[model samples]
Target: MANVRQASWDGSPVYELENGTFLASLIPEIGSNAYRLRDKIAGRDVLRTPERPEELRASPGHYGVPLLLPPSRIRGASFPFNGRTYRFEPNTPDGHYIHGFVRMRPWRVVDTSADGDTASVTTEFRTADFPELAPQYPHDLTIRARTELNGASFVQTFSFRNGSDEPAPFGFGLHTWFLLDGEPERWTLKLPVSDIWELNEKLLATGSRLPLGRYEALNEGMNLEGQNMDMAFRIGDRPVEAVLSKPGYAIRYSANEPVTQWVVYTKGEARDTICIEPLTWTPDAPNLDAGPELTGMRAIAPGEELIVRTTLSIERE
Candidate 1:
């Protein structure tokens, strides 16, 4: 049977979930980030975590499966939706709001249960509960996150609901830092990509796309020997699957429909951590001079809800 417990990580509150094959940690106090996931049978950590919990709080997105509300960068820290402009404070030196601030905000753990072969925890964040957010993003929004451990697989589901009468723009992303053991050269990565979003010098999409011919090797598995990537790819109109393989095992990440893009980043030879982010839309979607169909831009109408699920499973290779 699987089990869950309220624990502490370096004096911070953490919910620990353990099954027969894996051990996971969820921090509700800091973005409900699943900061640590370890595969017991393979004896390896699947996600890269900081040495101390404080380090993770200092830089949330770089560590665990941090949720990006609008994902990646936004040009000039603002965008247009329904003839109204929504704005955010720019946090990057380049004058872009890189990855929305939801990941750094606190979430409330609403439930935790262990039944049969699964153990899970559910956390929630509501904009209505935070009065300060109205001045910036006045929409009434509720985000519920549920993390589950079922056997050898780890699953995450995020449900977003717009409580406002007006339509609300929506784009969700997870900046997941997948770890690579042994030599980085021995690792392999495969993405189900179609086209690459062309970006300006500031790393925001430029309303143009490049053929995947230049990155054809990624469709078929490619080695990480000297690969340096900080690019986003438009996913085809189907389910998405991406795999990162190491010597003894492989980790597969998959998502269902409504997820149309992925961003991959790595430090090449300097580090063993790689981030293959799943996003609902390309960065700067609203700012792009294109239709929502091409940009993957989306809006949740009044009383509407959007749900996206992503799963990470360990497989022996």
Candidate 2:
């Protein structure tokens, strides 16, 4: 990615935060083109790369995570547009598409500046902004995905401008991956989760949120020794605070608006590295009227724009 003029954040070929805590690298090129994060101050890796885990570095919890969506497709084949039905190609083999408008599109650097310690990068996207989007999504809209690093945080802001004559329903959030301690089972999850949506093998919701009968909140703790989750839970999406720990290290996470939903994935195994995804809506949202959320789907009026901004960070405890 260190080329003559590909337009990257601060400075390419490396990574570090102003506070000199988080570290990101542009590697794992092919599958998931993204930067990996490491908390240098804590001497702990905030994310996993192929070098760290055999199963990581590629599409693992939005590995290189991005704005709108990442790791796959934006499959909303049929969306309502003025009482009309539209279709889209499945972005991935999973059937439905994903990641809004800029997932597969490389961002064009609009601004880059670095002082002594702090650095930032801004990217923008624009197309005919309508019908072109119509073939992909049912609505016409303009979106921007920005990735920035200050101290211990990697914030991605995704903004949208509804180019159509109505509002478009949509959801956006981090599909971040947190590396667990020894053997991927030495850590536990602590959340305020009360119910989980039942999904079929396709990872689509079955139209319901059932109170956790077996999976309980980690008010105290729960072992990952025998847990497997490719599931999303309704946690109010109120910027939930969570903690992951091992022998001598711990990770405490919290976000704005108190996220109340959680999606724990086990990567096809009964157990391994768990994907504790903090999302803005339930899966197949807007697509499936399942749980309670904005559904990443919105209704915009003529010449109206909708913007979604969220923040989350890592703390060493």
Candidate 3:
């Protein structure tokens, strides 16, 4: 096996892990994003990237697996916690604080190791380093992320520590987009979910859960032809599995507990790719008055940490 190799993607540093069957790429300069995961034998990229590397550098959310802290939107870019109001400058023009700020920021490489069977890299981001983000988030947080490739599996782990003296609300998730070998019509999906969050016109959750109804097609295997959806579903204690398959290959994604929400996006305009976001909380969770257990927000006490792990396994038919 070959050891992990360092290369440059449009002037930014990137690490590649390659074996006989797979190739995975990570970019630490961009929020430690894992921008590519390919099955060499299958000749397909399990994880999608933007058409132009420059585009991704200019807009990280347009491609790659970007991490989302306090994932998704926070209505009005403000939320009240523990009797105090915290306000974030809206990232989107629509006046909402879209994904967290870390995705576009740089992260420090902590470690990298590779052997005959596996290759891995770890990166860290300290919120205290970004003084501009302090007033909005308030709590000092250290986020450590690791990406590892072993055999046909790619694993990602995120550990967030509360470096402040007071307890703080925390939630995080991944915005992973996947591409198939063929057209969207040739793909199939299977997601384990029972209910979905009802969203208002602005695409923010309305604090209501609705049965899947016809969307239940995802429970079994459903063809992707003509299907358009952008929704978030509730997850239970068991590990959640979402499979995307074409004729000759399949990608299985699994995330463990504490990731209580799953967001799926497959709009017609972007039929070439699908996004499956495993999140710790629903959109606008902080603004919603629901309890912590229901909102999937964890109040990490001082000196405490929260961790979440997700894996993607590829198989050839």
Candidate with best TM-score: 1
Runs of candidate 1 exceeding 4 Å displacement: 268-270
Sort all candidates by TM-score, best to worst: 1, 3, 2
Q: What is the lDDT of residue 162 in candidate 2?
A: 64
Candidate 2, residues 1-317, lDDT tens digits: the string is 11112333333322223446555553212222344666767776666454542333234445545434422223343444446555666666656765454544444545654554445555556545334665555555565655556565656555667676555555555565666644656777776665777777667666666777767656566766766667777765333766766666666665544244566666665343555666666676655654344333334455765554444466554
Cα lDDT listed for each candidate: 0.88, 0.54, 0.83
> Which tens-of-lDDT digit does each residue in 1-317 have in candidate 3?
74688898777788888877678888887778888887788777777776656777787876779988878988999888878898988877889888888888999989988887788888999999999988888889999988888788888888889989998888788889888444888899888886888989888988888988987888888888777778888865434889988787788999877788899887554477888899999898888866667678667899998888998888886
- Against the true structure, candidate 1 reaches a TM-score of 0.97
Question: Per-residue lDDT for 1-317 in model 1, tens only?
Answer: 89999997889999999999899998998888999999898888888888888898899888889999878999999998888888888899977898886898899999999987799999999988888778768889899999999987899998999999998888889999998764678798988788889988888999999998858888888898777789989987634999998677789999878788999999565257889999998999989987877778999988998999999998995
The predicted structure with the larger TM-score, 2 or 3, is 3
Better model by lDDT, 1 or 2?
1
Model 2 misplaced stretches (Cα beyond 4 Å): 1-19, 26-34, 50-62, 68-76, 92-94, 98-101, 115-117, 127-132, 138-140, 237-239, 258-260, 270-272, 290-297, 300-307, 310-312
Clashes of each: 0, 32, 0
TM-scores vs. true structure, each candidate: 0.97, 0.75, 0.95
- Rank candidates by lDDT, best first: 1, 3, 2
TM-score (C-alpha, index-matched) for candidate 2: 0.75
